[model samples]
Target: MKRRTFDKLVSFVGLGLAALLLIFAGLLNFGANFANDSVASQLENQNISFPAEDAMPSETKDQLAKWAGMKVVTGEMARDYSDLYIWEHMKGSAIAVMGKPATYSEVSGVYMGLVRGGSTDVEKIKQYGDLRQTLFMGNTLRGMLLEAYAFGTLGVIAGYAAIASLVGGVLFLLLGIAGLMHIRRTPEDATI
Candidate 1:
């Protein structure tokens, strides 16, 4: 094939590749931005705020204090609120009542066992009921926060991908331009 023609073909192919990569980068960037914004907005609407530094819970005092007085606005913040704040409080309450830090399933099973045994002590029934309710709410909140964390993580991954794609696009574009310049410098009668 003629050297010029071969170079032209390769240049066009490189340009096409650059265009495709750039388009992919743009789409990924949009997705990442959307995910980040959605997570922040949803958390903001909840109006959840971190503990005052001095009021940090005993077990998570140092970790929780990092975000003290800050409202939940990001997935990381949501995770901190759920795991450090809400989870600790729930566990503490359970320990106070049940004499142990137990999971929601554990509490539910015990409560159901008592009911099945036909226990009719009103105070005990109500105590279990209240504790179960609090745990249920805490678990639900934790699930939501974890979901936000997952989405935000995906967004972060997408952002990194977008950056890589952009770099690839730029590299391909430069290669394409260099190929075009090579074609210009090639002799018309050159064959390869």
Candidate 2:
């Protein structure tokens, strides 16, 4: 093939790649926006909020102080509430029952043992049962909040990816255009 024709082929291929990248950038941007909007709207509807700074203890105050008294909206806020608030509350509830931080499974095990042994200590058995119930509810809510955090994190990652894609698309588009311009300047008789 002629050198000019070869240059044209390579140039067109580069242009094609640039076009694809640009399209991908657009799609990624759309996806990022949708995910962010959906996450924000869902969290807003839930109306969860951080505790007031005054209500927070000294130990947790510094970490949570920034968002104190604010409604949970972002992934970071969801994570703070789920891990710091819900997890701490669950641990405290467990400690009250078992004298230490314990898992729901452990409390349920004790409750089941009490039933199986036909123990007459109704109060002790009831304590375990109540703790298990409370733990179950806390775990459920914590799981949901963590899921929201994960979804929101995905949105955040997608937003970054979209920006990267846009930059890459622009770079490749310039490169492709430069390649076409180079082909114009390239002589017909040039062989490489």
Candidate with the greatest TM-score versus the true structure: 1
Q: What TM-score would candidate 1 get against the native? A: 0.93
Best by lDDT: 1
| Candidate 2 backbone clash number | 0
- Which pairs of residues collide in model 1? none
TM-scores, all models, native as reference: 0.93, 0.92
Off by over 4 Å in 1: none
lDDT tens digits, residue span 1-192, model 2:
777788778878877877887888888878878877887888899999988998764556788889999998887888888888877788888888888998888889999999999999999999999999998988888888888889888888888888887787788778778888888888888886
> Model 1, residue 96: what's the lDDT?
83
Error of 2 at 58 (Å): 4.9
What local distance difference test score does each model get? Answer: 0.91, 0.84
* Residue 131, model 1: Cα distance from true site in angstroms: 1.2
